[model samples]
Target: MSDSPSSWPDLATLRDRIDDIDRQLQVLINQRAECAQQVAQSKMAAEGDDTHFYRPEREAQVLRQIMERNQGPLSSEEIARLFREIMSSCLALERPIKVAYLGPEGTFTQQAALKHFGHGAISVPMTAIDEVFREVEAGAVDYGVVPVENSTEGVISHTLDSFMDSSLQICGEVVLRIHQHLMVGENSRPDKISTIYSHASSLAQCRKWLDAHYPHAERVAMPSNAEAARKVKGEWHSAAIAGDMAAELYGLTRLAEKIEDTPDNSTRFLIIGRQEVPPSGDDKTSLMVSMRNQPGALFEVLDPFHRHGVDMTRIESRPSHTGVWNYVFFIDFKGHTASSNVQQVLQDIGEKAADLKILGAYPRGVL
Candidate 1:
């Protein structure tokens, strides 16, 4: 069972090679840190502001460039993550941005939050979506991230509803591609897998695949995918449906990959903060309106956008809860609230609708 002498690596040579690689990495990391300091100095001088720091746009540009020019055995994603951690370390020389997201950890929302803030900022994972907003509203966290919508499914109604009552502003956004995986405990065999657990949405998304493969396995809905993974033990006849990252985070083995019903499933997340986002050039504004419960009343509400030639991206209605058949319409359009077209539309809609409220305008999440 022992390796042949010829098959073994030369220990002394390997050690020397490893030392050389380490030295190279150390030099590169230091150089990157120095550049970040220079960037900080320049930003300070240009803005003539001491308190202003952490450029989201510039960080985004750096990651975009890395993704564009990457020619790698490692993917654009892997390369970008490397730079993200590097920038995170560099940013730590200054103050850390505290961000909150819906979580108990190992959730997709947590991934979006981390992707947006990088590892530089302090990430606080909350149990509920409303908690994310509260942290940012209370100034306990500098910003918050929450899922706003999905590609296949519709908007996250709870998030949209929460915005109707909250005072926080949408400062930015990021879209993360959702890849679901089936994971089980290390000691569980594939044949022994029985019950599967996950969040309801996760279970629904993978229903067809699960029906085809594990038809007899009982499906259990849990609060979060991470919690579902946590519940699976080696002795139990159970496995959990989650993401690959969750599997790695919780020491679970992947039973399958990309097991969702659709290949392009993605979720859009919003960044909420106290300050308004100065136009990022490309942006979307969300609004809520309550129209009179009458015929063509909805058309009267939407007629302003058509007249102004503004692009309306999304429109959804929720029961106004004001007794018999009252409803509220949530709208997403292709311009920021600061733009003239958007401003005029708001002006017109204010005159037309029973009630209207501008949620927030922020950069559209490109990724």
Candidate 2:
């Protein structure tokens, strides 16, 4: 297991080469940052008082190119993350934008916002999903991030319903791998843990795992995984199922890791904003279609997508919240609103449906 005499010299040389590479990377990053500043100045001069520096489509295109061109010892995702943070920092130099997410500081939505926007942007915590929407609509924040769906559980109804009334657009999407860990405070002993705290979905996600492991523990549904992590800090015989961010924020000891019943559990979140993001070459469109109470309503609305050759990714139905309108269908399809096939589908559906609202046409998630 020991290195040969010949290998020792190569190891030292490799370390030195790494140092040289780091120096070159530093120079290139700073140059990029300076260029971003120049871009801001150019916009200010050209656009007069209505200067906007952040472009969701532009960033998405850059990241897509980064992934496409990657040839790496590091993974495409690994390299893309490095570029994402670099772009975030450069964007901050242009102008730091504020984002609000559903949180008490360490929730998954906050993690999604940071992942999508990068660490350079200011991310504020909101008490509820509706609050996040209100803040963005009122211009209290530049953007808001909210959970849309989970792989194990179905769609988030609150977020989908929010679209029914709000004017906010879907600027971007972030998919976070959700890892639920069993954790306890310093005062809690591993064997003595008798109760488990987690959000309702977290508890449901880990149901089978909990049955096999901590069968006797009482499972309590908290308002959030963060709130569960917060409460467990003061209780001796209590543990919480939460993600890494919450566990780290609370400084709790992890008793079990990746305890979700489903191995690849993840949640999708959306970036809600005022600006309509242009197509990133790769994109998806979300729409809310209201249909009157009539026979073949579903087939009539969806046939257009099939006829136009538009791929419908998801379709969920909700109550229209009115007596006259019986069905409110939320549809997500593959293509930008700008494309001919997509426009054709919209046009066909517009003639049949009671009302149609284009929620957003946004870049598909990069990471």
Candidate 3:
């Protein structure tokens, strides 16, 4: 006879099954951690004290593999993030990574650092982009994360300038989707918010939204979004425009969400490290080229890339500090420096340009 609906396993039975699965998950996770520890031992035996535990390219490849193999109710990105945290914990069994980022804390740079290195990393907050570079250069951290460009605001000139002075390599890249929110303190009244505080870029990104919603409100630019959130905490007449990270860090309530005028606004951040990252199957190379001032100098510099069929992803011109009239082009393109075609293109461009610095070849952002 067929069983009645009541005879089927109830919610409690399903929960018990979940408990059993959790137990199995715990066992498998510990086993993975043990394997990571064993891997560390093998590395130490092979390379002694000079062994590098963090392999950025290998990590990127693993994450991409996980995403590709994922098949579940969860999205590929969600699965990859889960694997990210798992890898983070396992890597901690070997050694924790210390990362430096531009911050007062609770900033997007910090978010990118955490996203790339996972929670197992020790993240140090630096006051400025230059400070972040200095910390990594001084061996105070394993790596540094800095904002290179924003979709809406163009390139971060300070970050680009820092690269010109530092020898750090680009180890990896992270693209973070930015969602600016209008937040207020618990004691603040949304109706009485007389002023809005945010960073200049944030203000600009949300200009249209602010104009439509709070037309008469005075907008003030602060040093950073976290600073703006902190300033609004004690003021009943002020609100802050920042991201969810800042809002949660300062215990502010979101009055409106995703207030940025551009719905798909995102920022690209770079991971700077003392050690060079080997090429992953998929990679990108960045270079800063200074061409002799002449007609078609830019074309001469770019022609080699096109001739080689190397896809140029982006190119930005910055004023050269060495000469008033000279300009440097920061170019990013697909393929790794180690690849034959990339090497040929670089050699060709090197012959044409006054100076060419291959920043580093790193795996493109997968998640």
Best of the candidates, lDDT: 3
When 1 and 3 are scored with lDDT, the better candidate is 3
Which scores higher on TM-score, 1 or 2? Answer: 2
**Per-residue alpha-carbon lDDT of model 3 for 274-328, expressed as tens digits?**
8888889999999999999999999998899889999999999999989989999
Identify the runs in model 3 with alpha carbons over 4 angstroms from their true place: 1-8
Put down candidate 1 lDDT per residue, 204-234, tens digits, no spaces: 8899999999999999999889888888845
Per-residue lDDT of 282-360 in model 2, one digit per residue for the tens? 8999999998788899999889988889999999998887765487999998999999999999998999888999999
Itemize residue pairs with steric clashes in candidate 2.
Answer: none
lDDT of each: 0.83, 0.92, 0.93
Worst 10 residues of 3 by lDDT: 1-10
- TM-score for each of the candidates: 0.82, 0.96, 0.97
Query: Residue 97 in candidate 3 has what lDDT?
Result: 90
